[model samples]
Target: MQRIDRFTRRSLLKSLGVGAGLLPMLEVEYAQAQVPAPRCAFIFCWPNGMLSTSAATGWPAPSATAAGITFKAFQASLEPLRDDLLLLDGIDYRFLRDSRAPENTGHACNPGMLTGALFKAPGTGTSSIVAGGASIDQYIGSSLVNLGYRGLPSLNLGVFVKSTGRLSWRAAGDAVIPATDPYRVFDEIFKGVPASGGTGTPTPDPTVTRNRSMKKSILDTVRKDLTRFNLRVGTEDRKRIEAHLSSIRALELELDRQAMPPVVVGSKPVLPPGVNTAISENFESTTNMMIDIAVAAMAADVTRVVVLQLGDQGNANVILSTLGYKPAGQVGNTGNFNGHHAIAHRNAADKDKVDTWFQS
Candidate 1:
């Protein structure tokens, strides 16, 4: 495949002998190509089921020391990230509230919560239910992709708890399928060419190299056929072929960018302990890294949109550990709690612990 530094639809039509009268269609393609891509990203920071209480809710009684700074229980843990977040309160999930059907209250809630349709539990029977409705992210992703943003619509990432269940959900409310392994995510971000420069079509893992070759081969086949068929084809078909070939060339150029080497995952000299020890110390560090990756992807124009989930629904206990609380056994058996959802069931009297947990 020929490499492209600058591409224009007029040049393409001239090479293919598309008629001068068809210039209007080429003008539309040129306009789209000249426009810069728009970028949008969202991160879902699920610190597990919250210990919602008065201290976690209403305005805290004013402090004598600072006028504007009011401190609540959960609000304190968020102090560091306060400026970066928009905390919305009292919005209800009518789907979960109104439906009498059994909701997948744990990790199951992760998908359904956004999809707005009740997602069938992973292994429960053969059929799935409408957990809620199509989630906002899914709707946006589909719309963007359809609008000619061939760039990745979303990058689904995670620290642990692998599966499609971690990153995102489809428009139909099915799991969006995530890349739990950092390396795989990296590959998906950049799949063609080589780690170093000078384009001899650099080497890659078998699958990676093969996918690239296959794409090129198919495009080559189309280009050859189109060149011969253009004389016989109608104006509409010629225009369609011209537009498609342009898209294929643009995609190939994006693949070339992938040849750049990946940045190493972590900067530390030694690995930390626990679930994310292999990646980083705890949920906070892992999440921060995930954000960095997403930002880079956006900056590189790799994707127009991304959905980042902090952790799985019921099993996301890393935040508990990241916030500096004991994992097990303590006064009131507080630290003994394993999962976040399990801890959220506490009554109002346990406000202190609940607030402490969220503060983490």
Candidate 2:
């Protein structure tokens, strides 16, 4: 597939609708290529740190602290987008230690990172961990002046995460649990999006499934404009655009694969065979699916704000062995050490391997 740059992809996204598979007709002008994609903010909460030990304070990426033009070997995974990345390392989370919230570790750090609010401790009545303020996602998502968009205010998805260490906070005392199930999230975001006469595509409105066909591929939906678009671009550019479209088509198939009609088992509806129902198993695929859905949601203008928390504090909710990384307790390879979180505390060397995968 042709690797499109962020700006180019977004610029093209304004003219494309690959997520919901349906868009309004275009206004019949080449100027649509110049339209900027909907602006979005994505926050990825990694399971834990790359630090040699749990006691480490800041990120070890050299480019983050020392002003540098290149990503170090430690950041090999980000090397592809090195030029596009802004390494603002060493930005202290001082708000975590303010009067309202004192800095803590283990189960407490995730809350204050984005919200700047202290974690409200459990008391006589309230028995859950909650941030005392709205995290940036909700803060900006709710702002009509800033990001008043047509779709959801924010879409939060996760991979194998559990109820604890929730990263997104909707408001004071409201810890927004991320949607860990990708299939459900995909359906909720891409289910209904119809065109109003097919001249130009309307933004994806999750609330509108009234009169639209839910089965047409996005390529089919935009076939008319796509042909027109092909006629205008240079031959080489057209080839590249075609490759990009192929990827979109693949994404469409993937959505369909997982969304197969649910089967009733013992009077209970269960996901189809293709869906990754057990997020903890085949986790690598599950994680990728969630991310793909996230990007598609933003690309389709389903939502302007998306948060993909890699995992919960267990970080153990998902088994790491699927990716070939064994956890700490797998003595002789027949045991069940599911998560790599324990490794970070026990042996930094083993944890470094997991860290490299995340950074890379």
Candidate 3:
């Protein structure tokens, strides 16, 4: 009986071919299995408005003499991406234009831009107004979830936007609040994966037993097998394996850095101290950070759809000076246009300049 048992075990081990030693190679193969890249949709919403002109500006105009459209100077920046660009002209949101409040057109149009429904304005004022239905992004995101998207359905990110000014709505009155902090967004996207060099194992002090001992034994064997396999692999294969391992290590290091608390400099911290406060209050930096996080989340398959609201319509406080433009003074008969919102309401020249900067 003992001899028969020994023979059975030996046959099983040989059948496995390298037995436990094959685990490392299997691990590498499993890691290399190409997960089909997730299909992504990104909606970038900007505030105020855009320039619509057929003249010196880059805006395209329907040709009077020719069959095709004519592009102007302002669109020169978009020349490289001209093939990919889709220009939709004369498409107006009739809902906003014909809404109940004719006086508060901009405010009403902000929430209704993506939703395609009139804003449900509160009896009191515009402060409590909300979208009348789910926005397009939300509908697409929900549909994707139903179609078996395993990751987060959507990521709503915004800069200088309030809940009232949100572009994505889940329902008539349900506004999806965005994560304003870049660090928090980063942490949320990478919450589950183990940090670099972290044992990722809970303390075994209280539950240490024979089972734990067996697990340790198996892990030690796996490590030894990995080392032996590494020695036998060719230079090219070794390099590939090393590169993957290095990527894993780098990811861990980044996680560790993100987890670290802000370093104090003199009286205040170098980074934003409050979780509520944005990582950077500067419009440019905040927009860039949100975009970076959105890209990272999409690449990691954390979310298939992302709606990035650059600024709220009413409160789009973009510092025009940063774009090398002095505040709009009276141009011929135009009045003083102080801020972005004011400039947007000015003559076509001012609006076109702002729009060009935004396009760039």
Say which candidate scores most in TM-score.
Answer: 2
| Alpha-carbon lDDT, every model | 0.47, 0.53, 0.54
Error of 3 at 303 (Å): 1.4
Candidate 2 on 215-279: residue-level lDDT in tens?
A: 34445666546666988999886975665555445334434432432111111112344855564
Error of 3 at 272 (Å): 12
Off by over 4 Å in 1: 1-39, 52-87, 103-107, 119-133, 162-167, 190-281, 316-322, 325-360
Give lDDT for model 3: 0.54
**lDDT winner among the candidates?**
3
Which candidate model has the greater TM-score, 2 or 3?
2
The alpha-carbon lDDT assigned to residue 322 of candidate 2 equals 51
Between prediction 2 and prediction 3, the one with superior lDDT is: 3
Candidate 1 C-alpha lDDT tens digits along 1-360: 111223232233234332211111111111113454343654453534554445555444433233345557555764554334333334344444444335434444454555434544445521344333445555555566667655555566666454434434544434555555554565555444233322232234667766766887887788778778877989977975675565555456545544333332212111122334343226556555666566555544556456666555444243345545445533242323533444544544343453454334
Ten-residue segment with the worst summed lDDT in candidate 1? 21-30
Clashes of 1: 14
User: What does the lDDT read for residue 26 in candidate 1?
Assistant: 11
- What TM-score against the true fold does each predicted structure earn? 0.52, 0.60, 0.58
lDDT of 3 by residue, 222-260 (tens): 555656677889997686456444433433333333333
Q: Mark the 10 consecutive residues where model 2 has the least summed lDDT.
A: 20-29
